[model samples]
Target: MAVVFVITLAMLTAATVISGSPVTLTLERAFPTNHGVELNQLRARDLLRHRRILQSSNGVVDFDVHGTFDPFQVGLYFTKVQLGTPPVEFYVQIDTGSDVLWVSCSSCTGCPQTSGLQIELNFFDSGRSSTSSLISCSDRRCNSGIQSSDATCSSQNNQCSYTFQYGDGSGTSGYYVSDTMHLDTIFEGSVATNSSAPVVFGCSNQQSGDLTKSDRAVDGIFGFGQQEMSVISQLSSQGIAPRVFSHCLRGDSTGGGVLVLGEIVEPNIVYTPLVPSQPHYNLNLQSISVNGQALQIDASVFATSNNNRGTIVDSGTTLAYLAEEAYDPFVNAITATIPQSVRTVVSRGNQCFLITSRLG
Candidate 1:
């Protein structure tokens, strides 16, 4: 499935555009301003290293998530999202790691004022939208969607408040609110079908840690996780879109790529079975090989025991990680194949060699 950051989805209606067919959304690289290839590599490397520091933790938000950034890798790829009536556009990160979409709300504290990505940062004001409504504590979505132990409905109107703490000690706290979102669905690389879908999202009033850091900040994040609170699930449940989506990432020179929802017709595309009864899209890893040579390691090192432990294919993760037991063997095999003449260098925890001559 192509993980999608859905802005809006509508039941295919004759008034707007075709229904039951696939629709595409355009995506632009979040790091258009950072031109250095080495800097980008270092940023990606840092993110990979951060993986070692991560551990399973529970926090708020429909999906308890922590967001991290290196100024160079802050915006890997994001899309334009229009929220509220008299719509204001915000460039939001399309994250598949978590569920529940959120944007910094008006009167936000510690949110960035300026972003190096060349887009003006803006806050979402529910008061400004005539179509906006609050999700209260008594609401079914409130009771079931956000499973945080600290969730409380103590407001005068019983408004549901949320606290989202990330693994890296960054977090946001806010209340639940619903508003209209505008989306443009592209067809055949030219024509766009405009549609609006109503969605409930978090309007964060506070942000801390990396979220407060201005160097890599954006308007917010749009999560495409495997939960009822996710944008895809909301659209699918409302009959506005199918349960499947797909996206293609293009090179820097190509400007950007395409993200599509519903049915994608491509004969060149192949399919894989999703590991059953799992939250994220997971698949079993049977073996590891580099350059057609399978590494010498026990296959059981990649095995899963508990239902939740396994390898997952996530769109938000830019780096691949392996168990330390598996990592050593894999690294040794790769280094042995490199020519002795090329000197190796480590930058931001990434090992590399600047070789002008080809060696197999």
Candidate 2:
């Protein structure tokens, strides 16, 4: 169960606000290479001209999402796609670090019986709707093997499946399948009566993980990674060039960020100064310094490699878990700052100290 607590939304909002920017993030198609793939950097000012803000409650925190609707959008829960077929109305986390868009299948085991945010089975079963199908092994979307692990594959029919492991000791395993998706258009405070966009997506059929069991209501997840099969890529192939997404987290649980697509409202947003690095197209963090001290950590700790070059910056993950070397200095700095009276003994018989603070 990869379902995140609504309370976690607060942390997400905080992270988004901290990583502020109005720069245009670029995406490009690439060919596999031993070193790393390359991406096309399109100017942000040229692609985005407008942005819209939406508010939705995830049974806990109410956050904002900034995105557009000229093209369709996909939402996810527990690594499953929440809205796929017609009458698709559900909240989704617009993630840039992921590539798969999936929703819990109709026959999912241990799924909650409640119906509101879950996928509409009637719409999926309707003759008007396209049937969900599995991805073939030959498809480029299928993983050749698990990224950054000893996992290797020899099967030609390795169905579309994902094994998502999270920092919170939670994860999910499921096969990916495709289905038709729909989205309604709203313009200038009114729903466009004649506007509806159709989309294709990969819905997860099976799900099992810690978060899934905890947040039984979560149905699936939507991946927005820099890959050809992602929902963004799908839209781009259809001539929805230069799609953009921006999130502005709320100040509190009641207020969240917006997930915008196609364009952004530059005038209303604040832009962060950009630091150019090797154009992995992934957000690069040269280092993390708290207060004023630079913590010694592995540079790779700040990034995850995709196509040897792209690094995914995930706001959903909590705790700045730096590479092992960096963690030591960070821990030492914190320990040195705290008074001994508030420190707790490390449980592993290590010299590490855990301190509790009482802020007044």
| Number of clashing residue pairs, candidate 2 | 33
Residue-level lDDT for 99 in candidate 2: 59
Which candidate's lDDT is highest?
Answer: 1
**Candidate 2 lDDT over residue span 1-360, tens digit each:** 344221111121122233575444344333323343222222232122222333211111112352222111212212222243444444444555565555554555544445433333211222334554655555544543234221223375565556666555655555555555443333443333333233444443344454445322444556665555566666555553244444454434233344434444456776553224432245556676766877767676665454443233564433234556666777778777766666566567666555455633
The parts of candidate 1 lying over 4 Å away from their true place are 1-75, 147-157, 167-169, 186-194, 251-255, 348-350, 356-360
TM-score of 2: 0.55
The C-alpha lDDT values of all candidates are 0.67, 0.44
- What's the TM-score of every candidate structure? 0.73, 0.55
Model 1: which residue pairs collide? 2-245, 2-246, 66-166
Residue 60: error of model 1 in Å? Answer: 31
Q: What is the lDDT of candidate 1?
A: 0.67
